[model samples]
Target: MRKIFTTIVAGLLFAVPFTAMAQVNILACEPEWAALAEEIGGPKISAFSATHARQDPHHIRARPSLIAKARRADLIICSGAGLEVGWLPILLQKSGPQVQPNALGHVTASHYVPLLDTGAGVDRSMGDVHPEGNPHIHLNPHHILPIAAQITDRLAQLDSANADYYQNRYQDFAQRWQQALAQWEAKAAPLKGTQVVVHHKSFSYLIDWLQLRAIASLEPKPGIPPTSSHLESLLQQLKATPAKLILRTPYEPEAASLWLSSKTNIPALVLPYTIGGVAEAGDLFALYDATLALLLENANVE
Candidate 1:
């Protein structure tokens, strides 16, 4: 009996270190960052997105499931810049010190990228404006590498034993990503100045990256939903200026864009806003591929 107990204790002791080194648990605020984490961390990390592509990150609730995930997370990756101001703080409160803000495990993608639509005074009247600039930074393929590097560095720092492994993975991803960037830029050359209307600023980075001209938004303000009056005004505006495409994310309601499209004969396109937003956008690379495809397909619509 004594010998069996001792063997069991030894076995449990051995399992502890193996479990500790199993994988770094990452909790990402959105699907895009979660996909980026998977690209950089590979098999060494376990990543879960708190918000899926079909949901708006700005309006998530800090539910118990997310809190539970946060508590176990070794790292937290978020867009930041107050994008998740509504729910992230609640998750952070329930999370451990390791994943808290300013900690090694905390990575904010906005910190590493050049922000757009900044320096504007924010107020409720302006709708859901982020004073820290736009948080939807992932659409710009140019911004991915820096964020990927930051993720790699954070992963290496958290799991030092796999530092070399992470570095090699990052180098490979960087190479493939750079190649894709070239291809995307070349393919998107024709869309450089294509005029379009948007439902929201969700695709600001994407529009900027593709050099597409955004004539107006369906939403009168940043986070405000489109009203009948606003849509009528947009109908009048588009009839005069005449944008070729009406763009919206999968999560946004289709009513406004479709209404305007019906009136103006503009093609309303639903670009996948993130991974899983559309079936074709199953991963990071696929997300951009699908977005560009949709944009190009509708770019010349009469």
Candidate 2:
């Protein structure tokens, strides 16, 4: 019995080193990307989110701590298309890691999904606009299916020995995710044609999914904050449309939404915007599930 106990203890000690050596490090720019990384990576990944789910990605500070995390990453993922335009370049410069475009550590999930609002024109006069398009594709669950697959492929490239593991997990996740997306679409279908004024261009994918038209915005342009005149003008146009919903993210100012909601009776929905943005949206699937319910509920409320 004494020899058997000693053997068991020795075996446990041997396993600990193996587990520590086998893990992959992931550094994601946002929570949505971090959540996706966790899904595909399972227990073999250590993922870090540069910004919280509730913060606006456009305004994040490229602090020293985030750069330190990036330097140690085996893989770094981000929502490209100018979503992280404000801080990504600074991270690259400060981390000082030469991650080439084709390197294993460099991955952008945006390439996996089809982008919306690509046709929107950009000019400084129109405020801070993404020259590529709206970078908030994660708002719509339909886009997540493809994005997951892309990340799976990326993980395989970075850690070829674990390629099969990533692929298996991706296939399983895709099946479940597709079912969730289907339910959301069906639930939100009734909201089709609901005119909404988005605080930013963040919900272009959601607007496309629900067939909701963006009549105007609280922000005069893409990245600029709303002016008094802009809000006043939008209020006038939307006052008569009682059913029109105003979509705003968790980080956006509630003052404008509150004012419009009071004046025009439009319920300003402070949505999760991304997974983990709110306590209710604890995971990737819950974020969309919650958002769809809110938008649909408000559509019928008036």
Candidate 3:
């Protein structure tokens, strides 16, 4: 019995270092990054998102709990390009230098992906335009692979002991993601050049990827709320071109899209903009699946 107890204690002591190094705490700014971290980090990491799918990423406040999460995080992953400009700076300021910008522990998805709608000479009058570019890069499925790769590198850098484990999981995720992309592309083939009116420029990357034409935005400018006069102008403009649907993310107010739909005779569609944006968008894979399915359903392309 003494030898048996000694052997068990020895095994546990040997496992201590590995066990301590296994769990990495990742703080993602949004649900998409949280989902991607789960895909790459697998069981080796614990991921937490600051914002949910149904929340507006732009206007979120830096709560105390988020500050606590940032302080304890092994790495911080965010969309960057000024998407979280409102609150991330406050969180970083409070969390200290561990997850500051340009640090290895701080990873921004925008740094990995090629951004669109850049150099538009944006100003404060433009209403929340990202000077770095459209920060909604996650809407593009093509950007996911590079972001995932960058995240994997960061994971390995912060937790070198689990480097091989992270890489293996990333490779597997990459394979499955590529396969899923092919399926999404095939499914969304009919949506190419489909004209749509959007609430914001948030879906720019998705529209670009699917070859959808964005005729008008309900919000006259990015992040600006739709006004009666602006909607009137948009309605007049869209009538000439005839957009098939008026689209908005789950977080966006439905009134404007619904009003536009009623005025224009176009259906208003709420896209599952990210993980958990809709009941069907429970994860990254389901996110795209639900988005494309909704687009096809509304496009009337049977």
Candidate 4:
């Protein structure tokens, strides 16, 4: 009887820690947030991105699998500010209380970061401009620390038992991230004031950070595809005032940027806009490293 009682007590003791160590399932609206969550949450969290490096976050189908993942997620991290306005609300509705907007488990990075291009009154005629402002805040290295801090706070809240662990990890990540930001700023010095064209406004944050001059975009407007007339106009414009290079993310169709590049004799640079955006961009640190390297390489920097 004594031996059986001891065995039961030991089993309970082991089970308690195991249950406590169960990983938090986090559903991130974009790849950047997912990567940041991993940096802060470490092994205590399982981060999943709704969009990949190859997919445009501006538009995504709310597939059943996504709905299912939301349903099971213990927490939600998203850019908000209308970036995922199309489908995230639907996902949240299906996800139930676990990851609701106001719930403790839900954290939107945009709420914690300063936004640009705001108050541009909503007008369908203006193309896909977000009335709330530009949602690509992650590309700005300066904005990342605040977002990471928010993620850490939420993680600590959800798993209070592991609060110290998450905090410690955040401190280490913050230190490394600050170091990387300084290095990136110094390395990107050459790119300052370099003129470029883009497929969309996606690079606004990076452009803003590096002080790169974005002279024009392939799109007629925010989300509208470029019409032949618009492309012709751009070609004419470039003749008078040429840009250094044409820029686009890996997910953006190359034909337009390539067409412009060939006609103008300018290089079309496809940058890794996020973690997993390109082969070399496997994480946050790699994302910035690859971006600066690509921009520098295109500018003929050794």
TM-score versus the correct structure, for each prediction: 0.92, 0.88, 0.93, 0.93
Report the lDDT tens digits of candidate 4 across residue range 1-302: 99999999999887664425489999999999999999998878999999999998888999999999999998899998888988898888877775888788899889998998786466656676566788989999999999888888888878877888999999999999999999999999988999999999899999999999999999987788888899999999999998998999978889899999999998999899998878999999999999999899897643
Task: After superposing candidate 4 on the true structure, give the runs of residues whose Cα lies further than 4 Å from its correct spot.
Answer: 1-21
lDDT of 2 by residue, 243-277 (tens): 46778888887887888889887777878887776
lDDT digits (tens) for residues 1-302 of candidate 3: 99999999999888655524558899999999999999998888899999997899988989999988999888999999989988999889877676898888899889988889887678666565666789989989999999999999988877877788889999999999999999999989999989999998889999999999998998877878899999998888887889988999989999999998998899999998999989989889999999998999898756
lDDT of 4: 0.89
Query: Each candidate: what lDDT?
Result: 0.89, 0.79, 0.89, 0.89
What digit string (tens of lDDT, one per residue) describes model 1 on residues 1-302?
99999999999887654324579999999999999999988988999999998898889889999999999999999999889998999998977788998899999999999999886577655676566788888999999999999999998878877888899999999999999999999899999888989998989999998888999999988888999999988888887898889999888889999988899889899999999988999999999899988887878832
lDDT of 1: 0.89
Q: Name the runs in model 1 displaced over 4 angstroms.
A: 1-20
Per candidate, the number of residue pairs that clash is 0, 0, 0, 0
RMSD to true structure for each model, in Å: 3.1, 3.8, 2.1, 2.3
Better model by TM-score: candidate 2 vs candidate 4 = 4
**C-alpha positional error of residue 212 in candidate 1 after TM-score superposition, expressed in Å:** 0.5
Alpha carbon deviation, residue 165, candidate 2 (Å): 1.2
Better of 2 and 3 by TM-score: 3
What does the lDDT read for residue 156 in candidate 4?
A: 83
